[model samples]
Target: MEIIRINERPQQVTPRGVKARAVLDVPYINIMNLTLAPGDEVPSHTTPVDVLFHIIEGEGSVTVGPETAKVSAGEIVVSPAGIPHALAANAGTHFSVLVIKTPNPKNMAKSG
Candidate 1:
């Protein structure tokens, strides 16, 4: 069995400029922990694989397709493939989420 410790991973800046720690990058899935400081954001973009964002701590605004909503810890947000989505930490709080990509795509390039 393999064990992954979230906090032990080095934080890296994503292409969108948000801070994230890659957890898994296997053929079946890709997972990362994304942390956003107050007012930080992940720019809107569409990917080829379905995405799932699970709020791990704090709260944030999530935009999927044409709809946007506020989500707090314990909530899960879905973003289907080919749809634009983004995330932002509330102005006064931090936000942390687990980003999961199922059936990991060969090309993770933004489609839009």
Candidate 2:
């Protein structure tokens, strides 16, 4: 059995947000610890793999497709493939998001 620790992976920063510790990855699924600090946002983009984001801590807003909703700790949202989505953190908010991506599609790419 392979054990992956969430705190072991180095944090990476993009123009949009930060990703830390890819906890699990396999042929069919991938999981990661995602964070968007206050005033930070993941720009509107679409991916080929279906994604589910579970807010583990703090408050934020997520725009999925054409809809936007306030999100708080314990809330979860799923974005289907090809749907445009973005996430923004409220002032003073530090959110911990657990992302689950399914299918492990070979064509998965971040929209430029």
Candidate 3:
């Protein structure tokens, strides 16, 4: 078993609008801690791996495929591989998100 401390991980800029910390990355899964402040946006992008997002705090708008929804704390959203997805945080709001990527493709390279 492995354990990770979210606060201890260093943040990395992802997609120009969000900061993320890699929590745990195994052969079959990758977990990250994400934070987006007000006016911050995660640009639309797709990955080969399925992703699940758990909103730990605050509220935001999420665009998944052709649908957009307002998500709040405690909400969860899942996006399948190859679908486009993005997230926008409301002004003055701060949100923490947990992103879980599973069954990562064998061809993808892991970050150093």
Candidate 4:
């Protein structure tokens, strides 16, 4: 058994410019904590694996495919693979989201 603490991980900038930390990285799933400053945006993008975004702090707008909605702490959003999804912090609000991707994309490709 392994244990991981989200706050103990050092945050790093992702290729998309969001501050994030990989709290759990394994073959079957990848878990990350993403922090967005006020007005910061994560441009729309598609993933090869399904993703679940759990809001942990503040408020934001989450766009999944053609749908967009205001989301806040305790809210969870799902984005299926190959669908465009994006997130943005409210005008003066920051956001912390827990991102989970299942079946690791790289492993999926290898198994295909």
Candidate 5:
């Protein structure tokens, strides 16, 4: 068995410019903790694997495909594979979220 303490991970800037910490990365799945400061945004992007976003702190706007909604802590959002999705922090609020990607994209491509 393995254990991970989310708060203990070092947050770093992701390639997309958001602060993120990779919590888990394995063949089957990947998990990350992301923080978006006020005014920060993650541009829409499509993934090869399905994704779930669990809001951990603050409020933000989440866009999945053509639908967009204002989300807050304790809420969750799903973005299916190949669909564009994005997240943005409210004008003066910080947003923290747990990002989970299933069937690791790399592994999925290998199995195809």
Candidate 6:
């Protein structure tokens, strides 16, 4: 059995300045934890693959394509392939969520 300890992973700062940690990376899927401080946001951007956001803690807003919603822990949001998506932490609190990208975009590049 393989074990992945998310907290043990080194934190990486994305281009948008959000704190993140790569939790899982494989040929089929990629998963990462994103932590955003109050007022922090991951700007809207388009990706070539489907994305799933699983809320881990705190509250935040998620925008997938044209719709946006305030999501809290235990909620899951889906962003279809080739669409724009973004995330923002609510004021006065921190937000953490798991970002899962299916089919692993890196592998998609290698095969496409």
Best by TM-score: 6
Each prediction's TM-score against the native?
0.91, 0.83, 0.87, 0.93, 0.93, 0.97
Number of backbone-clashing residue pairs for each candidate, in the order shown: 0, 0, 0, 0, 0, 0
Which residue ranges in model 6 land beyond 4 Å of their true spot?
Answer: none
Candidate 4: what lDDT? 0.93
Kindly list the per-residue Cα lDDT of model 1 for residues 20-68, writing each as its tens digit: 9999988779999999999999989888889999999998899999999
lDDT of 6 by residue, 21-110 (tens): 999999999999999999899999988889999999999999998999999999999999999999999999899999999989999999
- For candidate 3, the 10 contiguous residues with the lowest summed lDDT are 103-112
| Global Cα lDDT for candidate 2 | 0.81
**Candidate 6 TM-score, C-alpha based:** 0.97
RMSD score of candidate 6 (Å): 0.7
1-112 per-residue lDDT for model 3 (tens digits): 7667789899888866579998887788888888998878888888887888889888898888999999999999999998999888888899788888887554365542
Q: The CA-based lDDT of model 3 is what?
A: 0.84
Every candidate's lDDT = 0.91, 0.81, 0.84, 0.93, 0.94, 0.95
Can you rank all candidates by lDDT, best first?
6, 5, 4, 1, 3, 2
**Clash count in backbone of candidate 6:** 0
Cα deviation at 24, candidate 6, in Å, is: 0.7
Using alpha carbons, what is the TM-score of model 3? 0.87
Ten contiguous residues minimizing lDDT sum, candidate 6 = 40-49
Q: Candidates 1 and 3: which is better by lDDT?
A: 1
